[model samples]
Target: MANVIVAGASRGIGLELARQHVEAGDRVFALVRDPDNAGELPGLASSSGGKLTVHAADVTSDSSVADAAKSVDADGIDYVYIVAGIVGKMEPMLEPGDWDTFDEAIEIMLKGPLRVLRAFLPKLSEGSKVIAFSSQLAASTWPYGGFYPYVAAKNGLNRMFRSVAIDLKDRGIVVGTIHPGYVQTDMGGPDADITPQESASEIRKLAEWWPLDKTGDFYKWNGEPHAW
Candidate 1:
C-alpha cells in the first residue's frame, strides 16, 4: 500500500481523502491546523485500524509543515495532496479594493501549498504524485468577479504545480492540480451539486491510475481534463 499524506485533513474533502486512504489500508498522515480541536481527525486516527496518523500542521506556517514532514518515514511518500484553501468574502471589490482579504486568500490557496511542497518534496519518491486543489473559476475563460482573490489564487496554484511537474518530470514525480467539483461542504455551500464523499472517492481513484503522461494538467473529480 502507498504512503499518502493529506495536508489540511481536518475537515471537508481533505478529511474524506484521509478516511478513504486509511480505509483502503494505505498509511495516511493527516495534517491539520489544530490537533487538539480538530473535529473528528483525532478519533478517526484512533480507530483507523492502525493505518492513520495525525500530524499538527498549518500549511500557512513553514515550521509546522517541516515538523509534519519530519514525522513521515524515510522510505518516501507515494502521494501528497494539498487541499487547504478559502473563498474569502464574496463581496464585490471597492474603488481601492480590499488588499487584506485578497492577500489572505492568496496566502492560503497559493503559498500554503507551496510551503507544504517545499517541506515534503524531499520525502517524495520518484513515482510519487503531488496533487493540489484548484477550482474551475481559475480558468481564464470563466468570466466572473467578486471572488477575484480565490480565482486568482487557484490559477496561481495551477501554474505552480504545472511548473513543478516539469521540473520533477525526469525524476518520475507527477505533480498536478484538480478541481474537486462544486462539492457540498461549508465552502461549497448548500446548493453545491456533489457531495464530499463523491469528490474524494473520484480523487482517490484518479490518483491511483494517474499516468505520468498527464503529469502537469488539471482534472475534474470525474477524471475529465479541465481547461486552464
Candidate 2:
C-alpha cells in the first residue's frame, strides 16, 4: 500500500478522501488544522485498523507546513494530495469588495499548495505522485462575476503544478492537477450532482492509472482531460 499524505483532511472532500484511502489499506497521514476538532477524522482513522495518522498544520502558514513536513520526513511518502482551499464570500470583481478576502483565497488556494509541495518534496520517493486540486472554474469563465478571485487562484494553481511536473520529471515525481466536479461537499453545497465518494473514487482511479505522458495534464473527477 502507498504511504499517502493528504492535506486539509479535516472535512468535506478532504475528509472523505482520507477515509477512502485508509479503507483501501493505504497508510494515510491526514494533515488538519486541528486534530481535536476533527469530528470524523479520528473515528475514521481508528476504524481503519491503525492505517491513519493525523497531523496538525495550517497550509496557509509557512512555519506550520515546515513543521508538518519535518514530522513526516521519515515516512517515505509515495503520494501527496494537496486539497486545501477556501471559498470566500462570493462578490463581483469590481464592486466594493473585501480585498483581504481575495488575498486570503489566493494565499490558501495558490501559495498553500506550492508551500506544501516544496516542504514535502524531500520526503517523496522517486516515483511519488503530487496531486494538486484545481477547479472547473479555472478552465471555463464563470458568467457570474462573484467568484473571479477564486477562479484566478485555481488557474494559477494549475500553472504552478504544470511547472512542478516539468521540473520534477527527471526525478520520476509525477505532478498533476485534478478538478473535482460539483460534489456535494461543504464547498460544493447540497444541490451538487455528485457525491464525495464518487469524486474520490474517480480521483483514486486517475491517480492509480495516471498516464506518464500526461503528467502535467488537468483532469476531471471522471478521468476526462480538462481544458486549461
What overall lDDT goes with each candidate model? 0.89, 0.86
TM-score of model number 1: 0.96
Best by lDDT: 1
Highest TM-score among the candidates is held by which one? Answer: 1
Report the lDDT tens digits of candidate 2 across residue range 55-142: 9889889999999888773568888889989887666768674688789889999999999999998887677888989988888644
Query: What lDDT does model 2 reach?
Result: 0.86
